[model samples]
Target: MDEIKFICECCGKEHESWPAITYNSPSSYSNLSDQEKEEIAVIDSDFCVIKHSDQVDRFIRCVLIQKVNDHCEDLEYGFWVSLSEQSFENYLENFDNENHETQYFGWLSNYIPQYQFTNSIPTTVVTKNGNERPEIFPHQDFDHPFVKDYYNGITKEEAEKRIKKILKN
Candidate 1:
């Protein structure tokens, strides 16, 4: 992992090292107005919830590893996915159990700027033991550039460009 650093918006505290490129919240939650957020949405490092128009949307923060074909280090993203109500409930129910492991269908809920039209890829969310955050895998048949990239991998220079684009550094 490279020495990527950022200050937290909430605490204004500097973090020393961030191994994976990260997104703080799902795009759906970020899209809500301040008022709507105040009334209906809540998020932390691992989960997010929004209630609006009489429907509830739940999201979980997950990791996606993207291969960098020419580099020793792979690019990783801390992204989110929207879960079905039952799936969401199942996840929440086992949130604290280190022994729990399962999989659920999800929709990718964040934007990856390197690729246009990157959101809402059909995904499988995998929960691992020891209570780590879930990981997501894009469905193979999803006909999109992002999906292709996920499987085919990117060049090291392309990977660095993406990191710079995200970090603005």
Candidate 2:
């Protein structure tokens, strides 16, 4: 038997291992109104980036899915943003329609420190369009401060330092 370990880039700490990362788009995407679709930026099909408009605010939801031997599990992470229309359009223009497994990084409004071993923390979205389902991994929810540091543009080094200080006490 062997033990696996991963050095987290966000917190700069060693974790036992990371689970396979996956993303899932809500089935509601197809049902969105044409106007809604116009305001949305489809990211590799698995993610829909809704811009901040008078009708709706900007936000992102990332789903983490894991597959074990015969079972599958999942959880959701998300955040709201205030991106400008131009920025949102840029993202839409850059979207790769052919590959659905595209990875996008954004700020997180919620943080689940328990999954520190995750390949990437809250901000990483792994698109699931045009790809096979992802493998599942064991997951657990632990208690920690729900920090908005990611949204504040805190670097991984700073986050890791803060986490160490918190855990040290």
RMSD (Å) per prediction: 7.2, 13.8
Quote model 1's TM-score. 0.87
Q: Model 1: per-residue lDDT, tens digit, 71-167? A: 5567889999999999999999999999999999999999888667734799999999999999999999999998998999989888878877788
Which structure among the candidates has the greatest lDDT?
A: 1
Q: Taking the tens digit of each residue's C-alpha lDDT, what string does model 2 give over 19-125?
A: 32222333334356877666664534323454434443233344433222211221222222222355344445545554644445443323243334323223344
* Candidate 1 positional error at 8, Å: 29
Candidate 2: regions farther than 4 A off:
1-58, 66-91, 94-100, 110-122, 131-169
lDDT for each candidate structure: 0.87, 0.37
Pick the TM-score winner. 1
